[model samples]
Target: MNLVLMPMWLLSGSVFPASEAAGWMRVVIAINPLSWPTDALRGSVLGEPAGVFAWAGAAAF
Candidate 1:
């Protein structure tokens, strides 16, 4: 599962800010199931509140 999980992890905004990603890559990040949890954790660690969409995405997974 490394092949799948690795790419998902990379695309989940964990390696770089999602905002800096290309438009198409942002779309990919949005669809990645791992992005939500990664966002939530990042927000928590940074003391930034996660948006509603992040919570919703986390819940969805």
Candidate 2:
């Protein structure tokens, strides 16, 4: 499980800046279900703008 999920975590835009990540990495992050909640929490706590998609995705989840 660690082996399988570690890569997903790495590619989930959690460890690195999504904008600076490679194109493929960004694509992976975009589809990652974890990103929405992470983004929402980050936005709420940090007063950052979590995109509409993030809210919608989190709501959908």
The CA lDDT of each predicted structure is 0.92, 0.82
> Residue 36 error for model 2, in Å?
1.4
Compared with the true structure, the alpha-carbon lDDT of candidate 1 equals 0.92
Decoy 1 TM-score against native? 0.84
- lDDT string for model 2 (17-52, tens) is 789988877888989887787788789989999999
Stretches > 4 Å off in candidate 2 = 59-61
Candidate 1 lDDT trough over 10 residues, lowest sum: 51-60
Clash pairs for candidate 1: none
**Error of model 2, residue 55, in angstroms:** 2.9
Best by TM-score: 1
